[model samples]
Target: MREYSYFVYLMASRWNGTPYCGVTSDLLRRVVEHREGAAEGFTAKYGVSRLVWFEQQSDINQAVLR
Candidate 1:
């Protein structure tokens, strides 16, 4: 069987500033999108693009639940 990885991540506008939570299999791409304001939502509106923290998960379910 093939193995897969997922991530649960936190993004912030600035230190002790607004925060955003998300899950993705492509952490780099997702963070880049947020930084470039490529999506229309809370993160873009509030500039929550800095990757403050992240945790890896063995499965998509675990990442999402986290």
Candidate 2:
């Protein structure tokens, strides 16, 4: 079986601006997508693209609970 890792991340539009929280397996790719506005959603609308914080988890449950 393949090993799986998860992440909890925080994104921001600008310093002292709006904040966004997310979880993903590929943090780098996800952040890039947000910056490029790949999806027409909350992140794109508010321009929440900067990766300000992140944490990795070995278990999905652990990631979500915190």
Candidate 3:
């Protein structure tokens, strides 16, 4: 049996400001990718790269809901 962690994360430009919501299986890698602008889309366009908040879920569906 393999254990997997799903994360619902919020990224912001600065403290208490515009936030971006996302979910990923690898939170650290995903965050790093966003910071590097490797993620093609809104995050890359808007430059949302700072991690502000995150939540972990055992299932993908639960993480998506979060």
Pairs with backbone N, CA or C atoms under 3 Å apart (clashes), candidate 3: none
Q: Pick the lDDT winner.
A: 1
Residue-level lDDT of model 2, residues 1-66, one tens digit each, is 888999999999999889999999999899999999996889999999889999999898999886
Q: Which stretches of candidate 1 lie over 4 Å from their true place?
A: none
Q: How many backbone clashes does candidate 1 have?
A: 0
Q: Give lDDT tens digits, candidate 1, residues 1-66.
A: 999989999999999999999999899999999999998989989999899999999999989888
Residue 35 error for model 3, in Å? 0.7
User: Any runs in candidate 2 off by more than 4 Å, and if so which?
Assistant: none
The TM-scores, one per candidate, come to 0.93, 0.93, 0.91
Candidate 3 residue-wise lDDT at 2:
98
Candidate 2 residue pairs that clash: none
lDDT against the true structure, per candidate, is: 0.94, 0.92, 0.91
